[model samples]
Target: MATCTVALTAIDSSSRQSLEYSSANQSPESDDEAPRMSLLRKLAVIIQLSGVNFASSAVNGLVVVGLPTITADLKLDPSLAFWPTSVSSLANASTILLAGSVADSIGPRPVNIAGGVVTGAFILAAGACKTGPQLIVMRALQGIGYAMHLVSSVAIVTHTLPRGRPRNFAFSCLGLSQPLGFSFGLVLGGILQDLIGWRAAWYIYGGLTLALSVVAAWALPNFQNEGTFKGTMRNLKVRVDWVGALLASIFMTLLSYLFAIRDPKSIVFICLIAMSLPLFVGWVHRQVKLGKPALIPNALWKDTAFSSICGTVALSFGVTTCMELFASLFFQEVQHLSPLQTGLRIMPSLLVGVALNVTTGLFVHRVPALWIVTVSSIICSVAPLLMAVIKVQSPYWANAFIAQVLAPMSTDVLFTVGLIIISDNFPDNTQALAGAVFNTASQLGQALTLGIMQIVSTLVTKDYSDKILPMARLEGLRASFWTMFGFMMLCTLWGAIGLRNTGRVGLKRD
Candidate 1:
């Protein structure tokens, strides 16, 4: 198998000959230089990365929407079934900073290739598991692989492409690819699970990932050697606050655990929160006072563009994810829809998500980032507010469906905008940091929203029917929509007041 992998890699590399010229000024204008297919190579890179996105999305959609199915099939407890995704989240969050450092020290090419290999391997392994514990362990490893792949891919995209409208467009296009994967996963995974089985979906995704890994080895540009050991050693000499990393991880883990347990008023959970909260806060302050390169760089956090983008990502993403997951529940459990039926039911919003993703990428160069974000946030909030007002007798084609369509447009539009802003703001040296932070915010925000919505939904349904009737479910669903409404409104306010207005095109380096 290993030999086969290497042979495949070799074949891929031979198909696409890339010429790396030394100087920054080197261009394709010269006749003698092995004719640089920069455009072709960039296209190849985007296509390759889009495959990675598809694989991850396929698996995640299975995990998220297939939760009810997986739990029932495996005979696992409903609550514990969250372990696969929770483990994935924990591992992803833990590995990103370390991977960022590694990517910066070593060129992104090797790290990216390594991640592709591991991601394919682990995703395949996940399919072979029979029990929840085994599944969680494999998923966690996959998370590590994902962090490496994501950081490496984004670093390559941001650094390899010159910083300008082209780079901004690439970032937006990549963000757009996210929804393509997600939408495909939802519709396709549901079809596969019904026609064959849920486990088959995993195996199929694994095959796709393995095939894409080979393409990556061939078409993606090799990591440009940005100089030697001396450059890396200089960065290593700068202090890395290991203590800060540990503290932050501890806080993140504990907070997530607390949220998972959904015991907001529990003394034990409250005490853990109380103790960890202050320690995490104090540690961040100490890192700043000592001028150390903490788990999160103080300088990066202080950048208005970076911070604004992060906030927008957190809230906007939180709403989209929460709405999607619970909407599945609303359709499946409340309205008694089939899994395929539920997937079809949500098509309005999901389809709109894909459309906006593509449109935003195409026009991002001509629009202001701030205005795009603000308008999207407002649209997102209004979509949910419209849903919140839906009556039990309301038809899908009425305000509910219209709101759903409008809802995801804003969510996807802001996603592209946020990615463009962050990619443009960070230095080439910090490409991994930029990717890690953006993904981290998006992922954590999703996780946080799921947990919070669980609590709010439970509260609203506490006194309701035993079978979770549609009327009761609708009430609980409204509460969740209100939560999303609040989040998107906040995103709008922050984007308006806090973000530094920048061109729709990416910023040029000083």
Candidate 2:
């Protein structure tokens, strides 16, 4: 009862706090500068923004599909094999807050362009690497660049474009581009692995992304006026909440590292990771009391809708990421499929994602967010459930294909809706931080699930010592699949209660 009262109080305060801009449809003509944005220019800007997502996400896909080939050629240590796949996410999770905070203060244009350049250069460097460690380092560096691009891209969309059809379609495209790029990577990685090399894939990705960055220069609007370099630096020093930012980053970075390494022996990492939360809480309390800017306003979580969306996004995205990785692993290891075959099998999810994103964009304003999120959560739960009970000899069409289609249902929907809700919860001016906070939740979920799933798989697989290696691996995957199922169900239940009052978002406004 006490907690509920506090939550309600926070909700009331937050209602007064956040201006619900993203869900209310203000047409493109609302802003004077918006009228001058020609259709061709709009399309170009959309491509430039969404293109970055596609390219960065493709790196993750390529890593997953091409891991065996990459490891073998680069002579990656057996122990560090997964690092290449996980490190990019790790890096992204660690620094996203800082990137968002900086972008919000200085302007997103510089940050976005710099990120693109860094991402392309690092990817190219990754391609040129001969050592596994070098590749991992480059991937980590590129992830930071991706953090810059990802956060800024969202700010650019939310701030520059008005709140109606143009913005809706753009957000939808942003959601679509991620899975689309991942699917593209899976197919492209396999083809390159078989014919040329994984290096060639990186070269292609890097070059194209660099080209997109160049286009983005002229394409993206100056929604937030740019400050001089000296002025920007000074603003960052004074306006930014450095203590809150530091506490948040340390917590995220340390916890993620512990999760990734999973060293039961590292008591120190465990203790520090545990300590970060309270310190962050203290910082938040200070910010709210002092009436200063916070990295993530402490009051935001008091709203049932925002909190629920954050939880759902973390779990849903984590599961989606896990499904993609584990599904590929299942196809290859349990069924003994080839890399190309594994990539082909996962293509169904991408098609579903594209379709859902488009549909959600067009009709989201007319539908209740509660129904959209909860129903999709129920449907996507089946994807992991299929894998949890599947037989080795099961036909791909009978089981895997359906799972693929179901896997993306909730997440793709949530990507657009969650962004809407998140954008709604934050002030319009702090779009970059909102993007960072949203992405941080997403990346945090990925980090948590990846770490936890890997742990589950490892422990479960170890118990099946009497079984053959393939059988043991299958058992591990099943355990993780069950874990994924639980996550989706929780997401569904959370939404059912939390979003009961969240009606028809994205409605047209003046």
Candidate 3:
């Protein structure tokens, strides 16, 4: 809390000239956040924010669970099937940095509601699509809206809630919504795919999103800023680092696109990817020289602890998402289970995620972050290995159910702790950007790991003469699991070394 005050106090008077009349940047734990609220009001706000995450994640589960049917029905090109699952992430990562700046310039409430509306609109549009390309485009648009909501929601929660256990619990609820929603989607998507069709599930989820949007419009806090629309836009033009944002977005977009492809070896592709790094670095340097608002300052990464957090964030997210998807595929494609059975098999992950999230939020203030993350990551690393070595004839109780229970432990823990540490490091006014940086790491991990694991799985599958056989595909999936285990181990090592000095985060300073 003192840290927040110090940062806010450092902003010089001259810099305040362009400040908008918005409540974009408020101190976490400020008494101004209302020292207390009624229980019912708190519930409405948490539900509205957390529900957004649930709806988005549920739809993602639908896509992953129903991929086979969707591909077959839409006559999607085999090469393009991966796009629907991943394109939204690419777009989300690309725009989130900018969205963070926008959220800060304006208020979070409008941004939150607008994002919900756009996300719902696109989800509905996606359901009505008749072609793979159409679905891919619509999902891409959803990413943009989701980015708006996610970044703004972080700002909202940080400013609206009293910091400490209350704030911690609220974030935990937000974290819980994602995996729980995804699991619901898995079961619901499975049931819908079997009983009716995947499209109906999308329709239902999309409608739920719009309803949530209405709630957000009414329930979210409306912070007052100083300037009119014209003044705000003018300030955005001058204060926001568009060049820095563009450079970062371009690099991420290019790299993510390359990852989505099966064979991406063109010299042009390689050169552009290579060039994007140095160019982005140079641009950041330029931003520093000009004393401008950089999207993400280069110096921020110099802190070994912060850098390590970002690295571990990527690996943890990558491994967890990989496990969820591949486990689903292994159940259906390798074990020859029906979609409903596959969804049921993955239910343990959802249950564990819910418990881990709430538990972490409750006790995080009492323990050192280093111990929490490193130990849990070590536990999680074992999950992929369990799946890798399991026999086809093994019962669910033997290793499969245990793996599902363990897969999500570290990720849910890291998300809560990481967000706290990362948010603390940033200026009080840049809370949305803090959220953006954290999420960008998660999205990047998912994009790169999923692509790399996909390639590894494909190559290993092709190593056998009869690659199409379930037995051979099982070997390939096992190879991917092995790859995930390796990454999870890396996450554990990095977290242990990086967060060694990170004492308990989210402690009350009031």
What TM-scores do the predictions have? 0.84, 0.93, 0.92
Candidate 1 lDDT by residue in tens digits, 240-313: 45566566556656665666775446667667767875776678688788776655655666777779788778
Runs in model 3 lying further than 4 Å from the true structure: 1-30, 35-39
For lDDT, candidate 1 versus 2, the one ahead is: 2
Best candidate per lDDT, number? Answer: 2
Task: Please give the RMSD of candidate 2 to the true structure.
Answer: 7.5
List the RMSD of every prediction in angstroms.
Answer: 6.4, 7.5, 6.0
Model 2 Cα displacement at 303 (Å)?
A: 0.7
List pairs with backbone clashes in candidate 3: 21-225, 21-226, 21-227, 22-225
What TM-score quantifies how close candidate 3 is to the native fold?
0.92
Cα-lDDT of candidate 2? 0.84
Q: For candidate 2, give the lDDT of residue 42.
A: 60
Candidate 1 residue 288 C-alpha distance from true site, Å = 6.8
* Tens-digit lDDT string for candidate 3 (1-510): 342233223322212322322333445333343334344455677788899899999998988888878988999998887788888888998898888877776767778899999999999999999999999999999999999999988887776654566667778878888999999999999998899988999999899999999998777766653267897787578767888778788888888888776463655666887888888888888888889877878898888778898999899988998898888888888788888898999999998998899889879999999999899999999999999998888898898999999999889998898888887778767777888898899888888898889888878888863755788888888999999999998998999888888888888543
